[model samples]
Structures are given as C-alpha cells and as structure tokens.
Target: MGGPGGWWRRKSTPAKVETYTRWSFHFIALSEPTVIGVTAFGHLEARAALLVMVPVAAHVALAMVTASRALDWTVGRRAQPLRLLWALGAATALVATAAVVLGRHGPGGPGEDTGTVLGSVFGATLCYGVGLTALGLKDRRRVVLLVTGFGAGAGLVARAAGMPALAALGTSAFVTAASGFFAATSAFSIWLLNTVYVLDEARETRARLAVAEERLRFGRDLHDVMGRNLAVIALKSELAVQLARRERPEAVEQMIEVQRIAQESQREVREVVRGYRRADLEAELHGARGVLRAAGIDCEVSGETDGLPAEVQSALGWVVREATTNVLRHGDAKKCTVTVLRPEGRVVLTVRNDGATAPHGSSRTGGTGLAGLRERLSAVGGTLDAGEAGDGEFRLVAEVPLTARPALEVAS
Candidate 1:
C-alpha cells in the first residue's frame, strides 16, 4: 500500500464504496474498544465508563483510517511518505506516553481512579492514523499489517480480562483474533488492486505508443525513399528530354538511366512501407566483431548465414541492439560476449554481459524497450528471451526460423 490513491485503486463509484465499507467495518470492530477506552479508562471515575470508551474510540478510529487508505490506494497515486509517517508516529507515541505518565503521577481527588499507564500507551494508537496514512502512501505493506494486527489484538485481550461493567460489553478473545485477520486481509486487498491496475495500465499504454511511434518512423522512412528516388528519376528524364530534341542514341541511354532509378526507388519504397529491413547475418557478425572490439567486449561469430532467411537475421540483429543497450545502461558490467550459431535449420543468437544486474523483468529499465521483442518474434513464429544465465552474467537470446531473403540478396 502506497500513497493517497495508490493503496487501493477502484476509480469507479461502486467499487470505491465497496472497498470503503469493508475497511470501515474491519477498522471499527478492531479499534473502537481501545481508542475510547484508553483515554476514558484512567480518566473516567467509574470503572465501567473506562471499558466502554476504550472499545468505542478504538473501533471508530480503526474504521476511519482503513477507509482512508482504501480510497487513496484506489486512485493510482501511490507514493512513500516517510516524513508524514514519522510525524504521526511521533505524535502517537507522545500522546500514549503522556497518558501513561499522567495515570501514574497525577494528583487524584475523591472518586478518581488512576488506571495503568500502559493502557494509555497502547490506546495512543488511535492517533497513529496519520502515520498509517503516510505508510500507506509509501506502500509499506508489511509494516501496516504488523501494527494493525498488534493493536487490534491487544484491544481484544484487554476487553476479555474483565471491565467493571459486569464484563458485558468487552469483546471476546475470538473477536480480537478475527479483527486481526480482517485487518491483514484489508491491507493485502489494497496492495493487490493497486499492483494489478498499475501493471495493466502500463502494458496497454506501451502497446498503443509502440504502434503509433513505429508508424511515424516508417512513414518518415517511406518519404525519404520516395523523395530521393523521384529526384534522381526526374533529373534523368530531363536529360532524356533534352537529348530527344537532338541525336537519338544519347536520348535512349538517358531513358535507360531513368528507368533504373525509377525501378530502384519503387522497390525501396515498397520495402519501407512494408516495414521490412533485411539484415545480412554475415554483415551483422562482421560489424559486431568490430563494434565489440572497439567497446572492449569479446564478440564471436561462427555460423554460416548463407542459407538463413531475412526474418531470422533481423531478429538476431535486434538481439545485438538490446544487449548493447543493457551494457550501456549497466556500467558495472565489465565484459560482454555475442555468439551466433546455426544447426538443424535454426538460427540462434546470444549476447551476454557480465555484471551485477538483476534478471530481466525484475528491473524497471528492462521493462521498457524490450516488450516489443516478444510480440515481434512471436509474429514471425520465433522467440526472444532475456535473463541472467549465471552469476554476474545477464544474457539475451533470440531464435527464429528463416523466412525472408538474406540482406545481400534483397535486391538480386
């Protein structure tokens, strides 16, 4: 649980009301006894009054705080608020300690009863709502569970031990245990809802943006191809026009040049529009060898790329990009290795970086820029995987069947 809205997320009204009701019930039942009793127990002239106030105040306080966290968690605005927690915690402690001190040392008049100071200290938690809110803001799940559990438990225990009011109103031990259980469940629900919503939102947003950005990029590429090719074709056609006005042989040659450029431009434009960029495995390996050497990482290539399809080559080439990016982002990595191999009609590419980086998906940096690889490879009936292969080694692997022509032969 974290932040005002991050603790529990249900932006809708019905959902908001539902979560609020549960938390309110859990909090009131668990806390009311202690919250009111703590202050009333020592201060109340009648022992009966002390018992009633303790449970009532506790219940109300618990319900209020729980409801607050539930609503805040639902809003998708989770954050850790350490200062707020510290401030509220200090204030709660001060109140509790003061109650205890007053109980022991205060001057007593006739009909006055000095209750145990510890009760005041324990009851002081009624004020912990502020810090609990802060902890919820920070999404400190475990701490809230522990604190709530203890507070609810102690209140019930005190109630059963016997209050002066015929022992009628105090909650039983079983009720106390139940309150603790409910408190924990409430906290977990908040954390779960927030995490699920956040992840789902992130995935959908990434999908939309990825498609849009790719379209824009491919659009620009198409324009570039068309512009350059059309310009060359136009220049050649003008030359031919001038020649056609004179001797015939030169005009025919100029027309041939125009045909070549126009054809080439058309081919390039089609490829760009189709989002097809064939990579020659042989060339990539050759390039990788030099690039890795310059970057001071070992690179090895030993596969015969001659018969492999272009899709496989493109997939493998992407592996190189993702691996290099991981290396650049993780500076602690000292060495990197890229290996290409082919056997049994399958092409495999592996890139490994040695460092102290966590496994893939475990780090935020890995989440972005790598998701597309999964769908991209799957569309072509292949797969890409990234994770830690061993100690100090982060590895990315790509294997896809050959489908398109090799980059060297795209034109031929």
Candidate 2:
C-alpha cells in the first residue's frame, strides 16, 4: 500500500484494487464479531461485553495507526523505512492474548463476579485467537499456528464453558471457514507486496539492460553501415587531399560521392530504430520469392497465417528471413519450402532449403545463423531446429506457447 490516498492506486490494473476491497470487507465481516463478540449473539452480559471490546478496539486502532504511519513515510514522500507492520500485528495479537488468558473464568450463576470475568475471558480469548489469526495471516510461518490456535481455542472454550452443542458447532465452523479465507487472503496480500517490489526491480533491471543492449546494437549497426564505406571514404579523402596538393579536380568529385552514401546510411539506421523500416510477413515473403527464384530454388509457402501471437509470428518471420538469406547468400540449394501450420494445440513454422554450395556450412552457421535463431526462439518460449533435415536439405522450425500465467499478478 502506498498511503491512504495511494493505497487505492494500482500499477498494472484497477481490478486488483476491486479485489482487495472485497477481501477487506470479507475479513471485517468474518472477524468483527470475534473482535466485537457479544454484540452479535447477546452471549455476554454488559460488563463482559465491556471487558472484551475495550482491549480489542484499542489493539485495532493502534495497529491501523502504525500501518498508516509506515505507509505514509514509505510511499508518500520517502524511501521504505525499516518499519515492521508484521511485528505490530504480532504485538497486538500478543497483548490481546495476554488480556484474554489473564481474565479467564468459567460460566457460573448470574450475579457472580467470577462469571463476569469468565465471560470476558471466553469472548476475549476467542477474539484474541481470531485476532492473532487475522493479524499474521500474511506471515506464512505464523499463519498455520494462528489458524490452528483459532480452531483449537474455539473447541476448548466451548468445552470449558459448557456452551450448547449447536453453539459450539457454530463456533468451530465459523473459525474453520474464517481461517481458510484469511489464510488465502493474507497469502494473496503478501504476494501483491512482493509483486510490486519485483516490478520496480524489473523496471530498473530492464533499464540498465536495455541501455547495454542498445549500445551494443548501435555499434553493430554502425559497423554494418559504415565499416567498408568509411574505409573507402577515408581513402578517397586522402586521394582528394593529395589531389588538392596537385590541383586535380576529379579526386575531389569522387570524395563527394563517398560522403553521400555515408550520409544515406546514417539516415537509414535512424529510420530503422524509429520503425520506418517495415518488416511485415507478406513483404518478406514477396521478397523471398524473388530471391529464391534467382537462386534457382523453388519455394512452396502455404496458408493464410492469422491469429498468430505477435512474438511467435515474428519469430517465424525471422526464420523465413534468415533461411532465405542463407539460401541466397550461401546455399547452392535447388528448392525451399516455407510451411506455416496452425493445428489444434500448436503452431508450427518450417523452412526447408536445398544443401549449400559446399557440403555443409551449418557446421559453421552456428556462429550467427543457428545460434541467434535459438536465442530468439527461446525468448518466446519456443525452440528452433536447424539441420540438414534430410539428404541435401537445411531446415529451421520454431514453436511457441500461445498463453501463459493468466495475467493475475496481485489480485489481493
């Protein structure tokens, strides 16, 4: 929770807030009677009611104040402190427990001080156990104990006070149900806190990683764009410089052409990053068709590919791009087939091409072709297979999951 104002705000969606609100109401309903016990059943006389309600109310008010203060400090204006709501909840449970056990008495004849103390003890102990159960619900180690304590406490109190059998049964049932609900609710609450922490960490980590990756990619693009061209430009510039010494006109003109290609390459790299360079499947396939034809390779690509997950389709498109690149650039293949299949349970993409000009460069394609494809496929939780699928053929296949982890990050 961020604060009173921001405790309601959410990062991923508004639905988590809605769910949290529901859980809060459920918890308050289920445990309020335990906290404000005699008000519901008229099970206690006035003095007994006073004894139990006072301490319970005090504990709750203090816990809320502590939680609110910590939330304000941590989220309103400053970094998280070493504030301990878990300890505060634990302490409340302890004090309530002590208040309860010390005041224990048995049901007795009316007008007996002993009976008053005993009622206080029964109601407070029941509520205290329930309170502790509610408090440490998010703390996994203590939750089991608190839940067990609630159930056992209800049964013990019922037996001690000679409550009616139905009353005792009702108490046990209520405690059991409450224990399960709170345990689940608390688990979900703790998970929400952890997920928020993780998302912050993930953002920071991705920032650093994205910077590093972008830097590396920029360097690669620059080399691809300007490496040989820069060398040519530098040689021509030297020629122009030397020609200036000789007062020659043509050397300087050649230098101007060199400058033009370098400028165009720079503009293209910028465009690529800005998404001006479209790499759609149809255009890729249309290009591939021509390239394969020039290489004397017959290509059979089938089906209208639709409803494909973006990552999967992108990966498959990449397979087609790289395979076609390999065929035109390196392979002496005679034929290629790019098949796209969407069967009931899985999607499949296969690219098969005839063997290389040489026997096999797949033994060496691992340097960039196969290795990069594997990495891309793995990122989408898919696999890539590259090999001579049969005699004198090279193939690559990518398969990916359609859906995973159904989007409920922190519902409570």
Candidate 3:
C-alpha cells in the first residue's frame, strides 16, 4: 500500500492517461441514454421496448466510433472510415426518433409526452457528430457556421414534428442541439489540449539531442588537440633516453626539449578545456618551422599570415599544428613544405612532406586528428584533404571561406 506521494510518482504517462479519460467520457455519455431506454422498457409493451432498445444500442455504438475519430483528428492522424460511422450514427438516431414519436401515440404510451427520452437519445448523436466535425474541418469559420446551422436546424425540425405544447417544437429542438453542441465542444477542446502536449514533448526531445551532439563535438576536439601533442612529447623523451645511454651531452638538450613540450601541452590543454582557445596562424607557422628543424627535417613556410579573420586563422592554425605533429610522429621525413594562398574568396593552406612512411596496415582515410580537423573546418564552411599525393610525398590541405562563420551560429 503506497502512500499518496508514492502513488503520484507512479502516475501514468500522458498518452495512457488521456486514453483512459477519453474512454471514461465515452462510458458516461452512453450511460445516460442506456439508463433512459431501460427505465422506459418496464412501462411499454414488449414490441415497443424492442423497437426503442434496438436504435438506442445502435446510436451508442456509432457515437463511440465518432468520438474515437475526433480524437484521431486532434492528433493530426486521419480517420477515413469515420464518415461511414457518422452516417450510421445519424441514421440510427433518426430511427430512434421515429420509434419514440410513434410509441407516445400507441396503446401502451406513457402518461405524459415531455419528449425527455427522445431528446436525450437525439442529443447524444448530435454531440458525437458535432465534436467530430469541429476537429475534422480545417477552417474555423466554416466549423462555426456548421455548428450554428446544426443547432438551428435541429430546433426547426422538432417544431415541425409537433412535440407537446409545453415542450414546444422550438424548445425541444434547441435543447437537443445545444446539449450536443456543448458536449462536443468540451470533448474536442480536451483532445486539442492533449495534442498540444504531445507536440511540446517532441520539441523537448529535439533540444536534448542537439545538446548531446554539441557535447560529443567538444569532446572530439579536445581529444584531437591533446593526442598529437602528447605523442610528440613521448617521442622526444624516448630519444633522450637513448642519448643518455650513449653518454652524449646532447642528451641534456633533448631532455630540456621534452620538458618544454610537456609544459606547453599542459597550457594548451587548459586553454582547450576553458573553451575560449583560438589558435594563432602566425604562432603555429613559426612553431612548425622551429620544431621540424629541431627534428632534423628541413621545413619551409611560404604564406602571408596577416589580415585574416580570427575564425579562419584559428581553423587553419589547427591544420598546421596537426600536420606538423603527424610529420614528426608518423614519417621519416627529410623535408616539409607549407604553403598558404588566398584565391577566389577562399584561403587555402597546404602541408606537403617527403619521406612519408605509411603506418602498419593504415588506410589513407582514417585518423582521429584529421577527422577532428575536418569536423572543425566544416563548422566554418571549410574543407580538408589528407592522403598520399604522389612520388613518396603525403599532403594535407585545408580550405576555408574568407568570411568564416562562427561554429555556434552555424549550428543554430
């Protein structure tokens, strides 16, 4: 036996709750006419009771179908079969109307002719039809006109049929149509509200997916930045160990280089984690030259690094950094050349290195660093290509529009 708090925590989902509520209304609506028909049964002849009950049962069944179709319409789904059911419901109501009118004048007719029993049956059918029409009709003005016409028409027909003077023709028809109209409107309004709730839930799901994708992109960027830098530091430290075994004084210099790279890596990682880090193209060009030269590779940089937008520079700076790191870690390169050009409203950066040594069982297509760069460049409407060019040379090229857009704005 859970407490009230626990029961609330276990409450049904919106879909299940709505379904239960709709069925509850259906049962309540049908019960009223059903009770009336049963009570009138005891007072009438056996043949009269059979005539009244048959139409009442048919009307109830068709009304349920109509309500179900209305619910479908509110949620943007089609209930094509409902047109037939609507017609059947209306036909059964008319039959019940005829039977009730004839019963009042029969040998076993009730004492008074208040028209209460007939109105209840007729009103239920009208309510079902009105509710279905309100949602199925796309035009609001048309729905209003149709509802008004239905009410007025029902009243006029009742008046012409010669109901009792006290429950005059006008009074009888108005009561029936009005009862149906209000019942239909209330049910349709509830269904509309539930539809809105479903749409809101879908929007929330999309928002959450966007957030998750951004987080994944950020994680990939951080991994790309750190992975290459750490690999370079490991190579330097290993080289220092060998030099130390040979008892060379250059071992101390190698150790110092390792220490410097380690410290730089720490600062870069902090900057990346803070999310405000923007790579400098000039700094990367200079750093690439110095690092390649120290590794005994002749490096030449030819480019104007001035007067570029910050976004373009940052994206290209990453290209240069990753290319330099790849040359050191993966190749036995004797020389490397980097070129930058602004042509046709785009800035292009290319890094070409000789003595390329392809990794064991490595395809030209995949690497975390290049893949991450491609994603980053694409965020600013840029592109990257990295693969074997020809004659023992591997090339990495990146191109970006001069007026690069921010990644956040692009995502939006």
Candidate 4:
C-alpha cells in the first residue's frame, strides 16, 4: 500500500491524468455487467437472466479490451482498435436482437413487462458499446455518425420485429440520447487528456528554451570579456616575432606585454565564472516574481536585502530559486509569498505556497534539491526547515546566523 501510494505521489501531472482516464473507462465498462445484470434478474428467472447476461458479459469484455486499445491509440502508444470496434458493434447488435426476440416470442411475466426491461438493456448496451467505439475515433463528425448509425439501426431492427412505428421511433430516440451522452463524455475525456499532455510538453519545452537562452547569454558575455584582450595579444605576439626576426631588443618588451595581457584575460575569466556562480538575492527575488507571474501565479515578496552579507544573500537566493522551481514543477500553486526577516542575530527567509497537501521534500523525505540547499546553507551556519502549514499550504524557512558570518568567512 505504501509503495503504491508513494508511486502515485511521484507521478507527474500528465502521467496521473492518463492513468486516471484509462482506469475510469475500464471501470465504466465493468459497471455495465452489474447494472444490466441486475435489471435482467429483476425481470426474469435466474436461468433466463443468466442466459441474457452471457452475451452482456462478452460485450463488456470486448468493450474493455477495445477501450484500452483506443486509449493507447489516443496517446500514440498504439494503433486504433478497429477490429475490436467491429467485434463490439457486432456483439451489441446480437445482444439487442436477443433481447428483442426474448421479449416478442419468449415466456412473458408482469403484464409482459419483459419487453420493457429488455428494451432498457438494449439502450444501455448500445450506449456503452457506442461510447467505447467513439474512443478510437479522432473526428467529431465520425463520432456523431457512429452514434446516429447505431440509433437508427436499433429502431429499424425494432420495426422489422413488429414494434409499432411510433414505438420504434421512441426506442431510436432513447438509444440516441443515451449513447450520445456517453459518446460525448468519452470525447471530452480524450480531449482533456490530450490537452494536459500537450501543456506538460510545452512547459518542459519552455524550461529547456530558458536554459538554452541562458547558455547563449553566458557565451556572449564570455566572448565580450575575452575578445579584445585576445586580439591585442595576437597582434603583440606577431610584432614580437617580427622584432625577434629583426634581432631587435623591443621583442622582449612586446613578449612581456603579451604575457601581461594573457594574465589579465585569465583574471577576467575567473571573475566571470565567480559572478556566474554567486547568486544575488535582490535579483533572484525580482526574477522569481516575474517568472511566477508569467506562469499565471501570484507572487508576493516582502523583505529587503540591504546590508546582508554576500554569503548569506547567495545562500538565501538559492533557497528562493529551488522553492520557486518546485512550486512551478510539482504543485498547482495560485499564490506564493516570500518573506525575509532579520531578528536578533539571525536572518530568516520564509517561502510559503498554498498549493500542496503536504510540504514537498520535508526532512523525513529529503529530496535532491532540498539536500543541496541544506549543504549550501550549512556552509554559512544556516539551517533549513520545511513542513505543511495546514489548509493545503507548505512553507520553507531558512535561517542563517548573522553573528557567525565572520567566523564562517574565516573558516572558509
């Protein structure tokens, strides 16, 4: 039980939606036997009911199998279940015909009410089978046509079996309405599942694009930093080579100048790398707000980073980043609040979001992101705490001891 629960919780949104949809259709198919069987038993003897349920059981099995395949096709996991659809349609026609024959010619009871019970079963079977067939279809017009065809077939068959014209029309209308409802439901479910998957893919694409964009920016910055120095070094080296070839003492000075420029380039590269690694708290805060708002989440930030130590700001900035990412990736958050407070000798940073039932990566279930954050904060004598705050809220608090900053820096 625990293993299954954990697995479910770990599933991404699209996986969960697909799982739910597949199982829902299976259960719907399963329910047909129970509902139709009970109605059959209520109207006929046990033996007669059993006879009627044999084909229903077969129809249900075919529906379940077809629906499963259809769902796979919907997700591009497999081809359409055309053979199963035809088999199910045939089974549905057989069952309805059996019901009609039993009603018109078989033993009767309760003012000949067997016809009424069987007619209802006919409609239900048509509904379930038609809906299952619709799952494999991608076109709205085709689904409409499928339902209409089944309804018309039901009425025409009834009329040939001696049902009054008006009664046959009524049966047709009933079957159409019932089958249309289930067909529409199946169509909508497929649409929703597809939409969810598309949105999930789009989100992942957006994240990848952001990473690529950042890489380009970093490359551009590095180019700008190194371009001029390298050009000058190349020019000076050529001049040095010419002077050396001419046996001039100026070659030595030119070589030294080239070495100096090379060393300066190395230093600038280190500065660029260091700046890239260090996170600025003020920039992170505004960036988080912009990103969250762009994703349609409301973000409220409260706090000032003025006078905070560089190490403290860097550690807290990382916390904000990880928290924001988790909110976007794991939870369906509508609003988030980030607060920073300085009390006594410690700086406290709190990030809260009303999107999760339980806090993600609480101490009990340490996650990679949170563990990395803890390591970063621990370097600066900080501690991290995360837990649920009730009413579908999760909060993460990080506190860094300001008084220990000097000692930490000295130790580092």
RMSD of each: 15.6, 11.0, 9.5, 18.2
Clashes of 4: 0
lDDT for residue 383 in candidate 2, whole number 0-100:
73
lDDT of 2 by residue, 40-89 (tens): 22555676667656656665555444433433342334443334445544
Give me candidate 2's TM-score against the actual structure: 0.46
Across 1-412, the per-residue lDDT of candidate 1 in tens digits comes to: 4678764563554456546645654554455455555556556656656544553454345435545544454554454444444444454444444444444443551123445434434353433343233324434555555455445544444443333332322322332344345445555666665666677778889999988977755654454345434544565677688779876678887688778767866786677766575545565566556544534556565656666665666555545654554454454666766777775666777777776774454352355445545544665677777777767677777887655333322211
Tens digits of lDDT, candidate 3, 154-231: 555554556555455555456456645654665566655576667778888989998997787677767656765676
Per-model CA lDDT versus the true structure: 0.53, 0.55, 0.69, 0.81
Question: In candidate 4, what are the lDDT values of residues 341-379, reduced to their tens digit?
Answer: 999889999999988644354443477567667767887
- On lDDT, the stronger of 2 and 4 is 4
Model 1 scores what on Cα lDDT? 0.53
Off by over 4 Å in 3: 1-117, 125-198, 358-365, 404-412
lDDT of 4 at 93: 84
Comparison by TM-score, 2 against 3, better one? 3
Per-model TM values vs. the true structure: 0.36, 0.46, 0.61, 0.63
Which rank order by TM-score, best down to worst?
4, 3, 2, 1
Rank ordering of all candidates by lDDT, starting from the highest: 4, 3, 2, 1
- Could you tell me the TM-score of candidate 1? 0.36
Question: What are the runs in model 2 whose C-alpha is more than 4 Å off?
Answer: 1-52, 62-141, 153-177, 196-218, 238-253, 259-412
